[model samples]
Target: MNTDSTRRWLALGALAVAMLTIGLDVTVLTVALPTLAVDLHANTAALQWFSSAYTLALAAMMLPAGALGDRYGRKKFLLAALLLFGVASLACAFATSAGQLVAARVVLGIAAAAMMPLSMAVLPSLFPEPAARQRALTIWITSTAIGLPLGPIVGGWLLRNFWWGSVFLINVPMVIIGALAVLALVPESRSAQRFRVDVAGVVLSALGMLGLTYGFIRFGEYGWGNGLAWVAVAAGVLLLGAFVLWQRRTAHPLVDLGLFQSTGFRWGTALSIVVNFAMFGMFFTVPQYFQAVLGVDALGSGLRLLPLIGGLIIGSRVVDKALPKLGTRAMLAIGFALLAGALALGALTTVDSGYGYTALWTTVLGAGMGLAMPTAMGLAMGELTAERSGSGSALIQALRQAGGTIGVAVLGTVLATQYRSELGTLNRDPISDGVNAGVSVAHQLGDSAMLHQVQTAFVGGMAAMLWVCAALCAAAAVLAAVLIRAPRAAVGEQQERLDDAPHVGQGADASESTHVS
Candidate 1:
């Protein structure tokens, strides 16, 4: 490879490592919660905040961070965000109290918000070729996917051998390496035109996302009966509605509302959200199944997820080769088909089912994610111009974040309701909490019958949730077949037409630009 070619790949490697840190932080805390409760003298509410603070901050800042990166420089913001992430990780490690850790986590989330969108926004500038860009994106996405399962493994090891704070400290070296690599390898890029910041749009979008994310999180924790969660969800909807109306009227909108005009961008983003909804829901439940039902520890549970990672790698590598021939529409249909089939198989799990069965279905599930996610992401991002990429990428990520959060809430409700129903008269007091708690109660009482009942109830609940996920995937497969357009050329002629089109916002030419495809 030439020097420029080598540098671009190296830069992508650095960005991927940075992305891995963000993904790791998303789940690593789950493993550390018990340790944190003991070390920090934290209550249940405090433990929930430890995770929610990061999630809420991430949702709130995503849109504004992307807009800022576009206005300033993506490289500058990304580099700064990396350094800040390292600093916040340090803060989290040293924090003596739950409140302090929560504060540090919020900062970590803000830095991550900048990194997620800005890292993606620069990909077009790095690899201008459509084929090369898809390859790079697959690698980038796979890094994040790997880190999600790795989180529990890493965290479990740290907690076992070291201290709880070591989980946070682990991010430091990766951040340092990523920051230096990004600084040395990546070039700066931003919008050529200077536009005023849309203060109204930023405020509205930030608050709306925060409210929406927090509401779903609350709902997951407290169930549909939580009045506060409903209020927050209602308020979020109203604010987002207002933000959309304001975007149409504002001279400089935070997001280019016109991006939705492209069929590829709209369908790609929507399908991507559907994939995340199923993916996040599975992650939320499966670990619990391993721990509560199968009698595995955190580390063992994490190890079992290896099949998923392996399957994802296989599927991504295949798509990187096959996507050109099959096209996004067909690949998406195939992916959702695999997902539906795998989830349907998973729904057949009973208390007597073995790990081999779980492994078979999870592998297929991961393969489906690999095929669908990058194809859908590439389709949406393929429509973006360099000028609007930051905001456009952010818009896609924002909706995805919302979808994943809602999935956890909705699926958690399904599981919890079914679990309670199966428990019947037995679902009282301590047993009502969750599978883990119910299992603990059964063991403590040394009641074999109660143990059998708890295990059966949890398996039934899990099966019900899997069925719901299977139905969603089946629906998405049909939609992908109907809605997504197949590519007409090998080199992505549609993308070329878009790139050569006039930039949006040039008066009379704006409307013309919106209709490029």
Candidate 2:
């Protein structure tokens, strides 16, 4: 390879490593949550906050982070984000209490908010060829794919051998390596246009996401009876509505609302949310089940999750090979259908179900996710130009983060409710809190009957959550089938138009319109 070619691949390597650290951090906490609860004396709300806090910060700042990257420099912002992520990870490692850990997670999320979008935004400029870009995206996405599975395994080993904080500490080395690689290899790029920042839009969008996400989390803790949840939900809705109105009216909006006009961008964005909702929800529940219901150790739980990781890799390869002939709609619909079917099958689990049974369905679920997520993302981001890429990528990722946040909150509530109701005669402090607490309590008391009851109740809750996931996946499949257009030669045509369009100062005066592609 030539020097330029080598640099591009090296930059990709750095970007992939950066992306992997973020993805790993998200799921690594799952295997460690039980240990955290015991070590930190945390309640269910605190445990939820551990995950929700990170995702919330990520969702809230994504748009603004994108805009900043566009204005300043993508590489500069990414490097800073990586450094912040490293520092935050160290803080998380040393956190002595639940509150401290949650605070650290917020910082980590802000850093990730910048890193994820900026990393993706750089790809189009590095590889202008469609085929090369697709290959790069696959590598980029696969980093996330690898991290999800590796999280439990790596975290499990650390939890078994070292302190519970070891998971966060592990990120330190990866960040150092990534930072060095990025500094040496990646070229700085930014938007050609210097548009005014939409301050109102940023504030409104951040608060709106915060309220909506917090409302759902509060619902899990206090149920529908809480007036605070309702009010927060209402306020969030109003703010989001106003934000949209402001974006339409503003001269230089934070996000280009017109991107929604593209059928690919619209449905593709929706489908991305749907898949993550199902995926993150499942990740939140299963680790708990392995430890609480099946009596597996952290390491064992991680090992059992291997089938899921394997399936995701295999499924993505399948889709990549088939995309040329089957096109976007057919492949995405098929992938979603597989996901729905797998999760629907998973809902049939009983207390007696073993790893063999769980693994079968989880593998299929992973495959379906691998197939759908990257394809949907491609469709959403395919239409964006170099100048608009940062904000556009951020919007797509912002919705994804929102979906994951809501999914965890909503599904976690379902699991908790069903578990509490099924607690039967074992209504007590720890038992009412969560399955993990109940299992710990039962073991301490040497109460085999209570243990059995806790296991059975948790299974019942998991079944209910899986059923809900199945329904959502089914709906997404139908939407993709009906809405996503076939893959087209539109990118080349659009690029030509952009080239021919008028330019005034930094901004292009082209229509920036998109046809179905």
- Measured by TM-score, the strongest candidate is 1
Please provide, for model 2 over 1-517, each residue's C-alpha lDDT reduced to its tens digit, 9 standing for 90 to 100: 9999989998898889888998789779987888899999999789988988997788788989988887788889989999999999999999999999999999999999999998898887787665567667777887887788788889988987899889999999989888998888877777766667889999998998888877876776777788998898899889889999999898878888888888778888989888887787678778788888788877788788889888888887887777656777887899999999999888898878888999999999989988888888877777677777788899889888767766777888888788888998887786888888898899999999999999888888988898899999999999888876545443454344345433223555434432223
Worst 10 residues of 2 by lDDT: 496-505
Which candidate achieves the best lDDT against the true structure?
1
TM-score of each: 0.97, 0.90
Candidate 1 Cα misplacement greater than 4 A, ranges: 488-491, 501-517
lDDT by residue (tens digit), candidate 1, 185-296 = 9888877667788999999999999889999999999999999999999999999999999999987889988888888888889988988877886797789989988899
Q: How many backbone clashes does candidate 2 have?
A: 0
Spell out the clash pairs found in candidate 2. Answer: none
Against the correct fold, how does model 2 do in TM-score? 0.90
Candidate 2 Cα outliers beyond 4 Å, as residue runs: 33-49, 95-100, 420-430, 441-450, 488-507, 510-517
